[model samples]
Target: MAGETDPLATEQPPLSAGDLPAELPGELIAPEVAALEVPPELVAQSLGEYVRAWGARIRGGDPGVLPVILGLAIIAVLFQIVSPGNVFLSAGNLVNLFQQSAVFMVLGMAEIFVLLLGEIDLSTGYVAGLAGVIGVQLVQPVTTNFPWWVAIMAALLACAVIGAAQGTLVARLRLPSFVVTLGGNLIFNGVMLWALLFGPFSGYPTLGDQTNPHVLYQLMWGTIDPLIGWIILTALVVVVGGSFWLRDSRRRRSGLVAPPVSLTALKIVLIAVVGAAVVAICNINRAHFGTIEGVPWVILIVIGLLGLWTVLLQRTRFGRYIYAIGGNPEASRRAGINLVRVRTLAFVLCSMTAGLAGLLYVANQGGASNNFPGGQYVLYAVAAAVIGGTSLFGGRGRVLHGVLGGLVIGGINNGLYLLGLDVKVQFVVTGFVLLAAVTIDALSRRGASVGSVAHI
Candidate 1:
């Protein structure tokens, strides 16, 4: 009686859906504040899901570098099919492509650091020439007889100073980058010409002899032994695969969503396959007398730099800040980002990279000429970055983009020459490609913005 009496008096009746409390004592709690979200594609739990998510992301605006890669493949096949000599895919021509792309790729990377910050450096081309001239002068026996490494540092330092000075004007004085770098372009070009004429050992139009600074230029042209190349490729595969696994595992352990294991494994396998193909291609005996050649040193340099820059941009805070600033400068400033410091550093990095590129240019050509066409080189660098899928409006790009774009440019140039086309046709084709890339970027960004608004 006592137990049943409370049913109509004080005992609680069974709760209905309408009578349920706002929250249940035993129910799972929904978060009041959501944590920062990552792209579902980046954290997919399966290969199929990853692909689906990636496709969705592409639809939303991040097309990545796949389009450029596909375009490059198509170009290669098309050129081979159309060329009478079938020289597009020839081993010698392929080697030449690697050599030719190195300077453009390096310069593109230089531009990328600034471009990501929504800035430009018109002076990089002449800056490179000036640095190369200084480096050559420092290493010449008649001038200083300094070691090549020392000359390299001094050259880079000079370029860094120039970049830092220009950066100061842009960042501190609030001057337009276009204006500052345009002035720098003119000044650096004049300085380059003067250095070529009066710097240390200069009598002929070219500073160095036929050897030109003693085997420095040969660095890009030299080949690693076939066995050594294979070994390096194997090591790279192992290291790369191991790294992916470790990084994913760490992320998972930290309670972060990570890429599916299968996807990571597939990436590793793909990379290994690509690396193997490159090594095999280079190992082909292309010499007339059946001499064995392997991967060129320039290829190694490019690969190394690509890896380094990719890590910097994807894994570092500085890189993240560059992107944030580019995406929304006002928001970044509000978030306490040191805009001036970051911008200055970006410029300095850009110039230093330009200096490195100049070294590569000299190495590839044996010497830097007074008529290095610095302005044209800068244009080419921009084209390479843009074609490789980087956006000109900033907030979207990567160093690898430049590398891929450089390949496309080099391919176009090489294919045209192989087909016996003149510079005029090449220029027209390249211009069209640049225009197409920009159009694609603009449309993609618009679509992404619309999608985001719709989601909101």
Candidate 2:
């Protein structure tokens, strides 16, 4: 019997792994398996679900700029109540606040470009001064007698070139950004001093005479007509609202988890209210000539710049690369991004924006000065960016954050000035605010890391 082949075991082809079937025996299937069902309400389908998701996101380490906005509102109300006759809430003071925020708004944005790459640019302040001086000299009879706009462009070009060189050192040499930018700050400041002190100037500390064109000066002091402001505001509201709605709808149609239509509408309505308020306030007859002023050019410039930068950072491949690099440099490199180019471009862009800020500063002051405290200005820029909820660790910020932060800073300064607070008190208050912002950033990051670990 052992040597004989049984009828059931008759010789045949061998069963290969591929010949194995997946069908289980009839007894193996569980009866409960057929009863399993997913509930519809458990899935995110309504505005409430969307809000819950946002709350979860916040709890998971993204507090966003909501705190800053709330802080701004709180500060405004506090100042309004404490200040005599609610002077801080006056239209004149509010107008001044917008004008005051322009420099930092630009500088804060400039810092963001580098900050997104987890880098810092300490030289932005001095770079701004140098660029501003160059602009003044070129447009004046004391130098090349170039057009004001040409002078501005040339100055920005110079800043870009300077940034590129420094970036080369940072990207190619792999030097520490803090050290490199520190040296740059000193060098640029020295250059600014030399130019103002000896370079074709009639006197120390300033470039160009009264005979110089007032175009640059007008930047900080000019306002558009009411009609133009209304038109621009309308266009912006309609276009921005439509675009946001369309984007959400498209995402939803494509089966993505887009925000609820109600949320989108709320955002649109809020924007419209704010826009209308600004326009209406500006259109009030405040001038001695009794003419209707629409909006300050500086405000328009800041908004335009904010929009442009938001597009760049949120919608571009270069921006994506910047974030990727900041998140993980090695991963970004392995993904075939040209790390050196992106880093270098970031530095150049930072300096160029600083250069624009410099122009605005000079415009605000009515002339370029060697005595500009660029170091202090840079600190303010950093503070603004941080306070607006941009993470110091990089890769987690938006240009809008910078704008909001700048506004916060401007509001504080304006409110303090109106309250007749001492300069020392202002400094102490600002320091505290900055410290709080940094603390928030640190805590949020730690929380997020912990949350991720728990998930894992």
Pick by TM-score: which candidate is best?
A: 1
Q: Report the C-alpha lDDT of model 1 over 131-248, residue by residue, as the tens digit.
A: 8877777777765767777878999999999989999999889999999999999999999888877543452223354343765665576789999999999999999899999999
Clash pairs, candidate 2, are none
lDDT of 2 by residue, 1-456 (tens): 578642212243444556555665553343221111111122346768656655665676677887898989988898889887886777767787888989988988989988888999999999999988887777776557778889889999999999999999999999999999999999999998877764545534243344444777767777999999999999999999999899989988998766678877887898899999999888876666767376988888888988888888888888888888888876667556778888999999999989999988888887776679899888988888999988888788999888888888888887888788877887788889889999999998998777555543
RMSD of every prediction: 11.8, 12.5
Candidate 1 least-lDDT 10 residues: 27-36
What is the alpha-carbon lDDT of model 1 when measured against the actual structure? 0.81
Q: Evaluated with lDDT, which candidate comes out highest?
A: 1
Q: At residue 35, what lDDT does model 2 achieve? A: 13
Give the Å shift of residue 81 in candidate 1: 1.0
**For candidate 2, what is the TM-score?**
0.86
